[model samples]
Target: MTYKANLTQYLSNEFKRLYEEPFNTDVTVQVGEEGHSKIFQAH
Candidate 1:
């Protein structure tokens, strides 16, 4: 598996854990080089 694949799986699991459903919504995210930073904005 590549880095992208692992990240995708992790994000999917997290979405399900937090929302109790699959991550099926359209979304965008900004990640910093530190790898632990996430920024979300509503437009």
Candidate 2:
């Protein structure tokens, strides 16, 4: 209902999707072009 609540929901859903990937597979975190890609961890 509130701005914070909406953002929280979106982040939670994203976390679930990323977590559901194969346990051993690295979750790629792309931000820009292929030369400027970035990988990050949830924690």
Q: Candidate 2 on 1-43: residue-level lDDT in tens?
A: 9999999999999987765453325434433445323223332
Give the Cα lDDT of each candidate: 0.51, 0.56
Q: Give the worst 10-residue stretch by lDDT in candidate 1.
A: 34-43
TM-score of each: 0.47, 0.46
Give the candidate number with the greatest lDDT: 2
lDDT of 1 by residue, 1-43 (tens): 9999999999999876765422223433333334322222222
In terms of lDDT, model 2 sits at 0.56
Task: Identify the runs in model 2 with alpha carbons over 4 angstroms from their true place.
Answer: 23-43
